[model samples]
Target: MSQPSDKALVPFVSVDHMMRLVHRTGLEEVLRGLADYIEADFRRWELFDKTPRVASHSAEGVIELMPTSDGEVYGFKYVNGHPKNMKEGLQTVTAFGLLADVGNGYPVLLSEMTLLTAMRTAATSAMVAKYLAPKGATTMAMIGNGAQSEFQSLAMKAICGIDTVRLWDIDPAATAKCAANLAGQGLRVVPCASAEQAIEGAQILTTCTADKQCATILSDNMVGPGVHINAIGGDCPGKTELAPGILTRAGVFVEYPPQSRIEGEIQQMPQDFPVTEIWEVIAGRKAGRVKPDQITLFDSVGFAIEDFSALRYVRDRIAGTDLFHPLDLLADPDDPRDLFGMVQRAAPER
Candidate 1:
């Protein structure tokens, strides 16, 4: 037997390895770095291949493939969302991803995306808030204290200078857990009794509840002027966090309109509803929060380009480091046309 060639080996980041990498680089640093990558990609949003995530929905959940490319490299994530999974002691969302060279379509990296997705989602939120949130904002109300709650809080603290996070959830235990996890993390973690209390005095309101129905976490009157809403949990069809009146009044920003129209908070709006892509705002083609009194809403649906940027960031950071293991994920032959010969030569005593 021969060792696999470098070309045949792909860098793999397991859950353990990904955690180690996060700790080694510092979670705050990783979040900021991922924001840098995401911002860069969003600045040049026209180059990448963009499409809505292909989703297969069932009574219980949805499985989706989010794929995008930037000419040189391509990336995609396989993710599933099963809100009921928590009842069975499983994560509501789990994911893995791959990156490949577009030239030959050979995989360059294979990694766990569950953690990466959390980090990227937080980073993307903070990034959008950086652009849309009121200047000098220090408090964020995080509704739905699930797996994403802590990450979102920390990212806001790290990237957007948010010093306080007010948390609430349908399950008080979840809020307790999130508050406990965020203790001594350089931010004030406040567990509120109701959604209105959570948003009180919060300049940024982030709703990331794990529900599959058209539930309104924030009503129109609940949202006052001069607030930025980062609505993330309502990411698929039939799920929404904000009320229609909120959408009617706030200046809405989205990742991609086609997908957001079907999957984000805008799903509750009209098909011809006007919205601005965040990329356009980042590129200065559109306005962000023009005035402090204007309410801004970012209808984030977790675009493929964000996953692509996260994968690229991970691939670049893991270079010359022991954060990843090599896996023989590709079949490579000395002679490209003699793949059969290469395989037959390896068979013994047949």
Candidate 2:
């Protein structure tokens, strides 16, 4: 038999190409597809090898590494959260990620994840909403209208059937940009002046604010019964969005308890605080939305499995598009036993 043609190298996807992939497929389609992948991963939760995220922090910001494996494949992303960077015309966060074949510890792909992170984050939030939010929920209160606002709005419109979004941001310009970017997405955007005004009469409340400290964007008094809270930005230790009282009254749900307890809104509660893990609910081992009066909280710290799903989803959608680029991050030896030879082949010039 003839030897197989040299397999094409792994594609390296850039921010520009990824955005096109997202735009062409339509945001709703992407969210719907991504939710399926995320939910599938949740069903096979036991199949995954997970670890708490690793973080390196400075006074200005935090850089995190989230890694996970499903025996066959492994992936990780390097992401930073710096709320102050935007003032200097830099992104508040910058990211890149890699997917590897764990069987050989070889990197198969590299891609810019800054924009991808926004997409994945919104996708994950919508996934939780589909399973936890009340049926036929069409209105959402999106707190913090910054870089993530447009993506969250798009995801909700695409997956949750949300046709109207109530937007609130401390900065009016941020809200304006959010509305402007989302023009003609087939949703009604209502800009509000305060957090309370935004949450009014909305079934879903998404807090994607970037304050680096514990700030109450939503108070206990503002939250009503049956509202699904998608808390996205309270991901780091000191950062939070909901008041402590709010968590106490809600039937809190988290992605991973151990990591979430340290990083989620549950951190404010006692060590023995009762909360449901979303995977159990998705697997039907636990109940979700048992009552209309139940205030469900998805304390989203943005888990690794979600990122795994996103990377996999992007890979499939952009397969033949040449939207990705390959990086020489791993070694492929002609002979498996010639490890030394591979090292010598890659040595620096004399």
Candidate 3:
């Protein structure tokens, strides 16, 4: 019998390997490269398959499947969100993803997307801020200080040149951990006492709390003009971070309207609420920030296309590198038509 061809083996990136890859390639470079890929995809947004993620909601959490394709390559991510998981010492979110060739329907790469999602989410936030945040912006207020806080700050530094990040969370220990993690990252990290203090003097206010309720992480009064709001925590149907008044006052931009309207911050508004898709802004079909004083909101809900772009970027970077291992995921018989013979031969050898 002949050995399985390369096509039968899928490249797998484990968690340890992913961390090594990040360290080997540099975190900032990876963030910037992911942003580049996401921006490129957004510019050609009309060419890909788009749909709201299929979700199964429960009292404790929700599981989701986010899928997208560009007609040449196909990608999808399986992710879950459970706020109570932290109490169990488990992650609030976890994910894995794959990329496949559209021509032959064969998977090319499989990766641990938990860390990659953190990077991609931050990259998406920073990329949106580059287009919508005030010109010459240098400070950001990060409202949540969990696993995502450091990534968001670093991505902003890499993409938008943000020099200072003010951190605040309900738990001081979380804030401390985030600050400690970002000590030598070349950015000024200020751990604030309250949400109001965190937003002070910040041009980009990012809310990423993990409460699965209509929780107000930021009040309307706390929000001021000329600030770009990256609201990522309001991802599920009932989960939100910003006050309804904030949505009413800001010019909201979203990834996909169909999904954003159902799962983003705009879910608080009327069904006919006016909002612009971010892809149009990247494509130059619509303006991002016309005036510096107009409040802008990016109600991010973690779209499939962003994951697709991240997978594409990782697949490219791991090429010819020791960052991935080959997995014998598919069965390739010596004769394509002789499936029973192959099974019988393996059974006898066993």
Candidate 4:
């Protein structure tokens, strides 16, 4: 009979361990690497197994699960969005994710995804902007100042070369917190009184408010020609940000059409409404920002492929590092037909 060996077992990663990984890898490098993964996934869009996200909505908040596979590897994330959580000294969102091997259906790694979601979301925005944003988008206006503000701001500055940030939120304290967190980040941070004031004369405009309903944060008059709007929030069925009129006037871009049609700002429009998927641009099959005077909008509802790309990124970047925990999601039986024997052996020894 074979006995268990003395070899070290799999290591588990905690939230603090992940933070250390981020600090060691550096945010800019991670963003750049994640962007490359996202771009590659988008380029081979047909190979991926895609689906609309599954959601569970409640009066207080909503929880969601996103899963995708690239034929070889599979990954999913368990995430919740509770806008009122801040009242209880918790983040509005909490998440964790898993990556598995499709051939064997065994979980290879598990890690906290709340902070990683922020990183991936910001990386995705900057990635889309790399293709859709104007050649030199310097000044960006951030309409929502919350937990995601600092991450988004840093992503733009590092990836898109944004030199100035204009911030505005309904709550002054939220804006103050955002400004304070980003103190001395090389970019000039400006706090504005209203959304209109914040977006005035900016090259790039990002709206990431956490409101659960259809909120018209950007109106037709507020949006100027030649502006790139990165819509980060409003990812669910009833959630929307741009006024219907604004969508009609601008060239709207999306990550995946099948899912975005149901979750993106395009949800407010008819099925026949014209919009371009960013993958086509990345693959050189379509054009992005053809002219400087053309208004462009990326209705980002977030996607599973981005998470898949993120898992791939973290795995490759932290290969030897301890940022991942080996999860025993699958039961391994020494003998295929002796599962009950293993269970009996594991029961309290008498």
lDDT tens digits, residue span 1-350, model 4: 23322121233456887788878878777777778888888899879898888889899988999999988999999899887888889988888887777997766667778888898999889988888888888989999998888888888888899999999999999999999988987889999999989987688999998877899999888988898999988787788988999899889999878788888888999998899988898899999999998889999998998888887877776677666655444556677598798677777756
- State the lDDT of candidate 1 residue by residue for 1-350, as single tens digits: 68789999999999999999988989999999999999999999999999899999899999999999999999999999999999999989999999999999999999999999999999999999999999999999999999999999999999999999999999999999999999988999899999999999999999999889999899999999999999998899999888999999999999999999999988888899999989999999999999999999999989999999999999999999999999988888989898998898788765
lDDT winner, 1 or 2: 1
Q: Which residue pairs collide, candidate 4?
A: none
lDDT values for all models: 0.94, 0.86, 0.94, 0.85
Model 4 residue 200 CA deviation in Å: 2.8
lDDT of 2 at 231: 94
What is the descending TM-score order? 1, 3, 4, 2
Off by over 4 Å in 3: 1-3, 348-350
Per-candidate RMSD, Å: 0.9, 3.2, 1.1, 2.3
Candidate 3 residue lDDT tens string, 190-297: 999999999999999999999888999999999999999999899989888999999998989999999999999989989999999999999999999989899999
**Which is superior by TM-score, 2 or 3?**
3
For candidate 3, list the clashing residue pairs, or say none. Answer: none
Tens digit of lDDT per residue, candidate 2, span 1-350? 12212232556888888878877887778777888888899999999998999999999998999999999989998999899998899999898887888887766677888887888888888877888898889999989999888888888888888999999999999899998988898999999989989998899999988888998888889999999999988888888889999998888999998899888888888888999999999999999888888889999998899888888888778777767666444445667698688667767778
Candidate 2 shows a clash count of 8
Worst 10 residues of 3 by lDDT: 341-350
TM, every model: 0.99, 0.93, 0.98, 0.94
1 against 3, candidate with superior TM-score: 1
